[model samples]
Target: MQNDLFPTDAESERLRYEPFHESVEILDLYEHHRSGEMDVVMRPLGENPHATPKATMDELQSAKEAWESGERATYTISSKSDGEFVGVAEQWLEWDKRRASFGMWIREPFWGRGCSSERAGTMSYVAFEWLDLDLVSVGHDPENEQSRRAIEKYVDAYCGQHDAVLRNWLPSNDFGDPTGVHVYSILQEQWRENVTTAEIATIRVGA
Candidate 1:
């Protein structure tokens, strides 16, 4: 599920997406988890924000196992600028349907730099173009405006019917109680017509 797309020269030489390797340090995952920036992701999944390092490592080890078994693909979003682990992008695959769900979260310090947008765009290409998958979809907590805006660039249309209120879906935070989420998706043909042309141009210039 890994590819040769890392160390990209397109936007920033220091920023690239690479697959999650077993050798990756557990401290990195623990640090990101404890940063308090990931609550946007954790709160929605009802996960503990104060997870122990061992627990974090175990989770990453499981992800690595899943990748090896072709059940999932996860990438470490890195920054060469300071050699830091900025965030992650994951695609959950369903081979029978030839479809995947794409998700990503960037650290707060990296926000407003278009990092999420570009990486999400690249992975969308990886899913629909490189992997030849039929569809890629993503869901977000309705209150996560950052996620909503980041995902809007990839999907074809919104699914109002599929978007429903799941009571107590998101874990309570300082802001408020749990909230409902919305879903959006893009089909392969829609990506070819709507996004490929521009993405290919950008990748070519940078590749």
Candidate 2:
């Protein structure tokens, strides 16, 4: 377990990505879901750690179904180099594009490397630029400073009040209990103002 170099494990073999470009490829992430070597995978907090279970073919199918049916977008969180699987992120919008929620997570090693922020920023960019949505939202576990710090890193990209929405709504992957979820958002007009520099930089972060 070297600190500087990425491991030679199969799960660590990832695709290549430039320093300032996005290399988000999710196929292998779904494939590498069985190895719970990373801190963040897909977990429904405040519920069963095994509630939705790990990512699988059926899970992908269900996500696809939900996307197609809901007319929303979803993607697997993949690291550029080493191709290590991280987490997943998606967007959910409501009536008239008035509001939309953004969610993302990553393995502990990849958390602060800006992948989550990258994905979150990408989600925001897409929602405002591509989908022409009205507003974008993100919810973070209160007690999870890492999650909160990640969200706050690019807080400028979003606007509106940072308030608690679902009290004990999300499953806490820790003990299988409902944990409070704090929500943040950015309006279309606000995003337009903050869209000046809306991109993430990619680098070979050590695990």
Candidate 3:
């Protein structure tokens, strides 16, 4: 059965992470994916960090297929001021559990701009308010201090709790060794209490 709570299309115009197909240029996205810096973090997560053009296209197509199948939601992050590609945001849904896990990767040059926090706010709104999911969660590689800090800030703001580290939760390197992850989650009720109306007003979702 199709889940009516899942949005077929959604975006945050003010936050700058819109629907992937609407704003992402394949070559531009591929360029970022192939960067050495990106590879260092993403490759361990099973992403083709040094992806070729064809591979990047195939991955995008695969994500589209997943979206159509009601498996996940993915968005392209761009600069609203200039429309420059900056990153990608993802939500992996577990419908039966009413939970969604979030993930993202930003370009090196765009780091420290609070893009992660904005994406977190908008996606939380989508998961709880738009999708009516019971829980939203995110995890980070233990060694990635930048991601850990960014995730902690938004999770704290949303009144989320840090769950225990899950050992061997993700691939640690290209060789497929295991690594632990720091998990955090926010319940729908917590979001209701902490996320203000003004913050929600800044996000716009499409049907």
TM-score for each prediction? 0.74, 0.67, 0.87
Ranking by lDDT: 3, 1, 2
- Cα lDDT computed for each candidate against the true fold: 0.65, 0.54, 0.79
For model 1, state the Cα shift of residue 29 in Å. Answer: 2.9
Order the candidate numbers by TM-score, best to worst: 3, 1, 2
Which residue runs of candidate 3 sit more than 4 Å off their true CA positions?
Answer: 1-14, 34-37, 40-48, 171-173
- Give the alpha carbon lDDT tens digit for every residue of 1-207 in model 3: 334544545445445665565456688777776666676557536554755888778778877777777788888877777877777899999999999999888777788988888889888988887888999999987877888899999999988999989989775566667778999999999989999787777787766
- TM-score attained by model 3: 0.87
Top candidate (TM-score): 3
Per-structure clash totals for the candidates? 0, 13, 0
List pairs with backbone clashes in candidate 1: none
Cα distance off (Å), candidate 1, residue 54: 0.8
Cα lDDT, model 3, residue 15: 50
